[model samples]
Target chain A: MSHDKPAWYERARKGPFVGNSFDARARQAIEKRIAGKGDPRRRKSAAVATWLVGAAAVLLAVFIVVRLQDAVPSAPSGNHPVVGAGTEGSGKNEGISAAVVRAEGTAETGKLQVVPLNGEKQETLGAASCMGKETDMQFQGSYRVVYTRGKESGVVIDELPEMTFIQPSADIVQMTKLAFADADVFLLVPQYADCHGLNFYAYAVDKNGGEAFPLSFRMADGTESNASYYPPGELPAVRDGQLVLPSGEGPGGETANGPQDRIFDLNLSEKALVQSPAAMAGDVTGDSGKKALTRSFVFSGQTYTIPYPGDYAEYFVHAAEANLFQIKAGTKKKLTSFQEDEKGIHYVKDGRTFTAVPSIF
Target chain B: MEHEFLKHMTTMDDASLRDIMAQYGSDIWNYAYFLTKNRELADDVTQDVFIKAYYRIETFRGQSSLKTWLLTITRNTAFRYRRSTFFRKVNLFASITSIQSGRSAETEYMEDRYVDDIWDVIMKLPDQYREVLVLDIRYELSTEEMAKLLNIATGTVKSRLHRAREKVEQNLKEVRS
Candidate 1:
């Protein structure tokens, strides 16, 4: 082994620029901490005492809450109506039919509440065990697929009145909802292995309570490819009902014209992925063709772009300022603060408040 | 200079904290990123690490270098993030592109394909192996220092380093073949 470090290692040592926004945010947090409770360095003993008291208070609160919950009469099994389930007047819940809500307890012990968007009707849809706090739900027609990310991540598929949880392979990290065929919902599962890179797998879940199975793809040479492994960052694109993946080297040695894309039509009925014609790849609209919904506004000579119809806790990035502001329901705050009250959305800059209008791009 | 910095760390004010962040922020951020493989989590971990360092500055015994101490905190903080169920929502594959930034255009263009491939292999290693390899190769930490930072024995560190290098070599061979 060489004692001297490689040139690449030296280059890697410099690391990525964390950006000025991060520094600003860190400084802001420190300032906030200092302003709130005085300098952290000066309050070591006080901080410890405060932490102990806080912990005790939290324990007492939890005990009282648990006792109070036990004192209340339990609702009969099945559809348990939740309090404050209706969002009739809430403008945000306009078209959403139903939503998966975290129940009263912690994630490990709680049950997910499937509450109607505009009605008081709610159903207790299984335990929240193995479900991550951060969940991505996709509404496909009437089928609702909730993909959770965590240590023991799994998917919750709700076909209206009935719901089922499917635990994917331990290696699978992400699950993207793909086009469905009949009663089967197809999901693109990306599994990562050490040194082996990421491999894309197709999973078909039957809404009629049938077990979910991995779908194998028929390669161009009539061989079945269980999964196509691609290097990190080279994810396969799903378009129309076909999966367009970059092809590896074939039996005929290296291709003089670079790697071609192998498109596979999802045949859920056959329970297998069949190879489609190469021209089909060109027929579907690529990712670049689809426009992302974004909203932008200028504040203090810097333009900030955020995702449109922004969700709670979504970050708004100001490139020039290198600052990130988190969006709440009606207000954007953190780092550089932007508040939206009854009057209008206000942007505070250098002891001055300016009203700003929101526009979509 | 490090001793002076450590001495001042105990009495670190807002300006001192800002100065410390400026000096060691990228290093902490990069280490956190390397461990967690998520940029957003890395940002959070970096901020948390500095805040933690500021709050717990009196505990700095000066046994390790200031950078190592910061990195040790960074590793622990990153591990805490990894263990947290909330922060585990990050897509690992998508985060691979994050490490490619902060390089000069000339440096990027002049980089050899072999070098890029090697780094790619290094990045894709399992967390345990990658941590050891990065500490050894990138941070240039001694085995003893790495063991201390990782909370493992020196022998274990050496073994993991061997396995990490072996895995990298194996992956590189596969890539080349």
Candidate 2:
């Protein structure tokens, strides 16, 4: 008997075990559910639940759109509160301990809402003409909001010494939500293609958008292309004080027959972006389909991958797992999962309710 | 030939439905597991797939094979499960569910280890890569069939499948090294 089939093939041979027990249980549940569709009593409860969810979705959508429309225009003039750290203005004064409500908005020449990082309320920070241009708004850190405005070319820092920085001539077609390696970070195209084809640029700004710094790097062949930069999948972010972005070969950042794709870590503090060892950054953007690159964040020196609205990082505590440790150090242990309840984000470890980090405002 | 089975599906009685489930239930469950990488959720999703198929049987045009149509449902159901708030909140059991049928302890252990390792690698792959692998490797669908199923160009499917395989090989190499 030959047993040396590939591991993957063997695994597929084993397949998922749909034993009689699971099948019977599933059959009963499905039968009941299907039967409930005909029974008026069961239908009532199902209809109520469906209606509630649908209503909530509609209300939330309407609320967000209304708020975005309100925030689009300039707020009746004068120094509108640019909500950020060290700014004491009319906005709600709160601390990082406040509940991180998912406050996001889309922008054009219209309004931009400063979603209350501190409260459940959506605060219209101010409005701008944005030259009748629109862009998506993403919350950075606990307070700052990163937005794109129309006709304006530079990578602008709203709450900064020079609001408009890295004023590249071309328009930004797509930008991802801000990922924080530390506090203040630069906005740049990690990988992008203009109508003219593969384009690349390195942009950087100091913490708090205080100063703009030049960012640069050499390709795998040790050559620099100024015509454009191809950042690959998602834009690079500062993780653990390291500016990490995906790097691949060929002109368009596509992985050709030659060298494999890797992640480059640039140190902004050194004022030069240098490629880190392949082992340190690994392949941040997995295959061309761009899976595997979960948003990884370092909290208390431990790196944890979290889904969108990464504010959940505050609740996770380190736990040990072999897979978690192999890829990177300080991975907020895998066993420590989370579930959000009415109280706030609750952390579960080893199938037990280990600790709860309430949304304390 | 399979169209006969699908054609009669609209009028299929509970006995016929059970027969259909008996024939295809395992296939559906396996496909769902490969897509979701969660055996328990796959179990629930499999049931939902069957239930949905039973209800929507009349809508079957038989343009695709019954298996392919069922699998499309399985993929959609699994993805919907992933997007649901329930999925977001629940971290159900991570271990693979075992069949009630008897298997020697040694056999089960070896199979579990292999499956777990392979799945660990597969799950790390992005959704598109994972989808093609599951569809091609598990279901043995051809490139043309996959192109039709995914509603993408045959060229795109071929390239994506190539890239997906390369990624899987690359990942395996990384682990071994």
Candidate 3:
């Protein structure tokens, strides 16, 4: 037999004994944590609308939806916490840590938009259009939540689980509790990830109103699946314009190394608002779907006004060390902010306040 | 306790099975974990090895320590881990459980999560190369023992060892620069 050897990786080892230093204690620890922190939505939160009467219905609906979108398990969830390679149980981890929880911010007054890094003239996801208009979203609070950052190609969102984990391709989806026109929609812009999928109930504030809207869909290769998720017209936060086309592809299915401005189509009917008030300052919309929603921040010079993405509508008016603003609508007053609390907003504001929103971040 | 039990334990003694496990459990587990890089998988392999040991203890002709036999099983189990991937999608262990061990806020903002990345690279290596590399880096198993477990000649084992080390060195070079 030829004795020609492989490489150093074939022979060199870090330890000497077979299975000597690995700590058996870590086995149980990891299992416990994963089972515990599988999904942030599983836990009880103050912001998410949770009630007993609708709990069963929520579960049933989410089960049906997530089972439809079979997402890849390894992809990070909405604003997913990354799983990095550390030294095998090494006592000291010199590397930086990921933030699990923090405050939020507010920047958009529903008027001006711009991308700092790219120097591109950006538009509020609110201004985009899709196959349909943005209407009231009717989903249960207890329903499953599938989330992705910006991966809206190939895999259909319908095949995911209620708590389906998806890649941040270029879009996001959520299960709404209730929907209404002129709603705090921009808050629906998922934070962190470029794309995400989610399922959460939106309250009509009136409680009596029903906001049942249609859904939309597209593939990673920019191919539109016949599966229409939401109705046409109303636009949310980040609408990859390309997806708006009936054929999920760029104009005539063109591909390029440059910008595909129309990755997802807004095709929204009305406006969606964040349910909660904003806090902190280090929050500014960043690299949203193909159509990123970004604004400059004075803090770290840049902050994400929008959240990575989740079933919950996120709003942060005062992002820690970022920026803040309080704006006005016709009959409604909105405090557009970035709130990563997973509940979206915290402080409450009435509908009638200002004519046009302000800018800060 | 395991040595004494290895000398005299009976199969019907269910309690002895656990008793024996408590003694050499860490050793077998270490072997399995290093080979698999996943704690849960290691635990599974450890369980299987001990269960087999419990029944086959009577077959020990005193040729090797119980640790050696179990290590052989661990190596074999590692191989099976790779082979089983063919039946699944992108078959490779992410060591996600271990990845979570260091989960925290500060690590996320860091330039790179080295621990997670390192495991990512480990999982990407070919099975043959990965097995040898994990065995060396994690457990430091000698070529002789690896050969015995792999059921190959010592020279062949050395060749694999040599190749595994080279691949790791080249990988380290890329990471360092």
Candidate 4:
């Protein structure tokens, strides 16, 4: 990704625009005033009046915000009321409760292996520092070895500072701790065998011991076939689930679509593979769990592995929107390495390699 | 209150529209400047982007990043300026009244010696390559993002970027020689 050019990203950190602050001010001012000013229809005209100033400012500004709007608000969030949809569903408890709830299966979490993306995978000290600080460090069982860094308020999977998260396997065998921290959250990612294409599906075997119906991608080609994945089921691949496109409004307000969506939430029980990056900071760990412990180990001059659950699940590192990489657990996080994203600054560590950490499942 | 929402203060109540300005006004302005090399023209393009962003906010599905969406609108607006009679009128106006002022700005800028050599190389590139070069370099968007922003294919983005980079590299070598 390097070249003679400034990498198309330096444009953002360039000189700030002359009129940015004022435009932001004007924007906030107008949006606030229009909050209940009748139809909010007339706001457009007033917006036109203040357009020039904001326009001038943005050309030189870097102060930015990326808060998601309350479109179809589930509950009264951060501030604004539910927007686009969720009018009737507003008062009721929604989200996780509404999505399909799966039974708790104590499947023996399998072993984990990490493979280098390419070339000779090297290790460094920061990764070592990350593991040294992990709590309840054990050497075995249902734990994960992640590639992270020391504490410095990290970013989540889809949130800012997107870090790469790759599932470790026998082919991808390697090791490193994501970062050192009191265990906090887990981030879910779609498992990919290669860069070809990715999707998750499931099928069944009938009395004839043959592959029955399957849920595959709705590709343009007339014929359909299972290309990569299989989910857990024997019913129509899709039905009640809503296809929530990028437009925010879900088809029938049911499903969700995002590149960084959690695979765990789809059908896994309370332990959905796709977690929202949780935290143990000031939070309760419930009375029914094993000693609040995380397994730990080392590799290639770097300490790696944290045994959390008796499952073969571990947080991987990656950058989402900002194109910056870091480690995330549940809802909590630890900053790891980063490379230059389009934004201000990013770091590079071995160009997309998937390293290993010990797994206890 | 590290970053309070700004749309509240303005008549621009469209959340997506304000998000557009907040997210990518800088990018649009830079793109406009890359095209016209004129601050005023860039300003015009920026204004058009938000206005359009405001009107079409509803059409925005979360499919693309906000930055990509804004750039698409800005590109269209800048192209519109090139086609409109308003451009001719404004250019003629500046030519008639600000000829002396234009010369003055040029002299002052030259004294600073900020040669836009890169943009010049970009300007010399074929339009297909030039567009990708400017968007990729100026906006820093990924190849995939640039394709989505321009409503083109990723392969197109890669192809144009390759040709554009070669052109720039050739230009740089020539300059060095």
Docking class of 3: incorrect
Q: Please give the CA lDDT of all the candidate structures.
A: 0.49, 0.45, 0.35, 0.35
**Comparing 1 and 3 by TM-score, which wins?**
1
Q: Which ten residues in a row are the worst by lDDT in model 1 chain A?
A: A132-141
- Ordered list by DockQ, greatest first: 2, 4, 1, 3
Q: CA lDDT of A328 in candidate 4?
A: 31
Q: Which ten residues in a row have the lowest lDDT in candidate 4 chain A?
A: A98-107
Predicted candidate 4 versus true structure: per-residue lDDT over A94-136, tens digit per residue: 1111111010011112111111111111111121121222111
Can you rank all candidates by TM-score, best first?
2, 1, 4, 3
- What DockQ does model 1 achieve? 0.04
Provide fnat values for all models in the order shown. 0.06, 0.12, 0.05, 0.02
TM-score of each: 0.35, 0.40, 0.29, 0.32
DockQ scores of the candidates: 0.04, 0.06, 0.03, 0.04
TM-score of 1: 0.35
Where in model 1 is the C-alpha error above 4 Å? A1-11, A14-361, B3-5, B86-117
Name the weakest run of 10 consecutive residues (lDDT summed) in model 1 chain B. Answer: B90-99
Question: Model 3 TM-score?
Answer: 0.29
lDDT of 3 by residue, A1-361 (tens): 2234344334333332323333444433333333454334333331132343245445644553344334222333434232232343322222222211111111122110100111111111221122112221111111211222133212111111111112122122332222223222222222222111121122112112212222332222111221221211233333211222121112222334322222232223321221111221122343232342222223233333332121111223233222343232242534342222333223333431111122244
- CA deviation > 4 Å runs, candidate 2: A1-11, A16-22, A37-171, A174-361, B86-116
